[model samples]
Target: MFDKVLIANRGEIALRILRACRELGIATVAVHSTADENAMHVRLADESVCIGPPPARDSYLNIPSLLAACEITGADAVHPGYGFLAENARFAEILGEHNITFIGPSPEHIRIMGDKIEAKKTAIRLGIPVVPGSPGAVRSGDEAARIAEEIGFPVLIKAAAGGGGRGMKVARTPADLAEALTTAQTEAKAAFGDDAVYLERYLAKPRHIEVQILGDGQGNAVHLGERDCSLQRRHQKLWEEALSPALNADQRHAIGTRVATAIADLGYSGAGTIEFLYENGEFFFIEMNTRLQVEHPVTESITGIDIVQEQIRIAAGAKLSFTQDDIVFSGHAIECRINAENPLTFTPSPGHIDSVHVPGGLGVRVDSGIYAGYTVPPYYDSLIAKLIVMGKSRNECLMRLRRALGEYVIEGVETTIPLFIDLLKDDDIIDGNYDIHWLENYLERRRQ
Candidate 1:
């Protein structure tokens, strides 16, 4: 086990990793920007270092600064808690070269899975179902149009290196294909510094389901069920639930097993998620997140597994603590990503938190880094906390989540609490009758 681990991120996830390290008897080093000087993680870590200014390019995203902090703290391993450089292949390689451990998958694995085109091809080679589209990246709008015609209308043009819905466009007909291709390529180039884009057949009203898996990098892996992350806005997941209300035991087991086996066979280590779009009782591979996901708590709640600890252990050459048979899925779990934003307008709300009240009760967990006096800097993501709740069934879980959201309070800033409160009462959300596009449509309706 590593004696000390450097957390290369901030906010709630940084604190989440710190708590995990403390439990495992590992000292933690927190690296923060100037804006996050009063951050909870910085206050709680055994030691803290100022990386750079508030700008992410000079701070959180600066590789040299992170390396310097690791060197100064004598950190034996680095744990990137979801974002920044979590899935950066070069970052992992640099750590390996420095003889420092990276608590994630191998650089080769990250590289392969990070590229959407390569990931889809790998999935297809492994016999995992994938959406029909171009065999590879289309070089021009003409090529995209040809592929769209062959695959039928309603194709999605997605960036090969994109995420968070930034570099994506949809074309429902041939006339729209050229514009979609141009827009996707331009956005992809701007967001990822790569102009490469690929086409995929878009499925209407598909439910987004992802399977979580852990591997030992030597062909041993196990699946811990799946999480339903269909509740999204602008491609960002707003809510997630485990033991998806959409899948039965047989369907879950089959998909989970296939994903686990394929990842293990590819020598994947630590934690990873295989995302799929499900519609009409069939699953189509969307992409693979080679690092821990933001919505991992829901999976942990149902599986009784400490995914962060498992990542560290795997990096330290430990085999999985349990086999697939030893794993058991229990009750349903739901997680609401509380963002500091206007509940109705969805604009970023960054200000001092005057007073706050976190809900507490059985099966309710709150993971946050904000305090009463802390100011939410506008330099990063708006997520401030994660409220996870578990219950014996989906209905019970929703009821518990609703109660917990009502009990929660944050002053001096707008939050999505109101949005969640309203959503909990909606018939579609309560009945779990939603898809990837459902939330966006609902929000549009509200605007109208």
Candidate 2:
């Protein structure tokens, strides 16, 4: 195990990583920007270092400052908590050059999976199902039109290196193709600094499903079932639940086995998610996240696994602690990403948190970094906490989640709590009958 680990990000995830390290008997070093000086993680860590100013580029994303912090603190490992440098292959390689361990997958795998075009190709080679579309990035509008025609109408144009829906466009017909391609490429260049874009056949009513897997980089891996993250707006997941409400036992087992086999064969290390779009009866691969996900708590709640600790162990050269046969999935678990945003307008709400009252119970958990007097800086992501609830069944889980949501309280800033409250009242949400586009449509209806 690492003697000391540096948490390379902020917010709830940083706090999450720190607690895991403390439980593992490892000392922790918290790196933060000036704006997060009063953050909860900084207070809990054994030691804290202010890397830079408020801007992410000068702070969390500043590689030099992070390296300096690690060097000064004598930290042997870095646990990037799912953003900033988490999946940056170059950052991982640089840490290696400095003899500092990055508690994530191999840089090569990160690079491959980070590129949407290459990720699709890799998934196909691994026997994973992918959507039918262009073989590679289209070079021009003409090439894009040809591929779209072959793939049929309603093709999706996506950035080869995009995420969070920044560089994605849908073309339902030939007339929309040119504009969609140009827009996707332009947005891709702005967001990822890569103009490369690829095509995929868009599924109209697919449910977002992802499988969580852990590997030892030594030919051993296990899948912890699937998460239904279909509820979204602007491609950002708002709610996630384990043992997807959409799949049965056989489907779960089959997909889990397939994902585990592929990860093991590839010698992947640490925690990763194989995301897919499921419609009708087939699953089409989308992309792979090479680090921990925000909704990992739901999977942990059902499987009784400590994903963060396991990531540390894997990075320290340990094999997987348990085999696939030893794994067992228990009750259903759901996680609602409580963001600091207005429920109605969906606009960012960053300000002082005068008080906080997180819910607690037998199967309820809240992972947050906010405190009574801490101010939620506008310089970072709006997510302030994660409310995860578990129950013997999905219905029970939803019931518990509803109660928990009512109990959660945060003052001095508007939150999306009201949005979740409204969602729980919908028949589609109650019946688990929502798809990827359901939330957007629901929100539109609410506005009207």
- Model 2: CA > 4 A from native: none
Off by over 4 Å in 1: none
lDDT of 1 by residue, 35-153 (tens): 99999999999999999999999999899999999999999999998989999999999999998999999999899999999999999988899999988889887788788888988
In order, candidate lDDTs are 0.93, 0.94
**Candidate 2 global TM-score:** 0.99
**Tens digits of per-residue lDDT for model 2, 197-309:** 99999899999999999999999999999999999999999999998989999999998899999999888999999999999989999999999999999999999999999
Alpha-carbon deviation at 369 in model 1, angstroms: 0.7
lDDT of 2: 0.94
**Cα miss at 398, model 2 (Å)?**
1.0
| Model 2 lDDT, residue 267, Cα | 87
Using lDDT, give the best candidate's number.
2
The 10-residue segment with the lowest total lDDT in model 2:
138-147
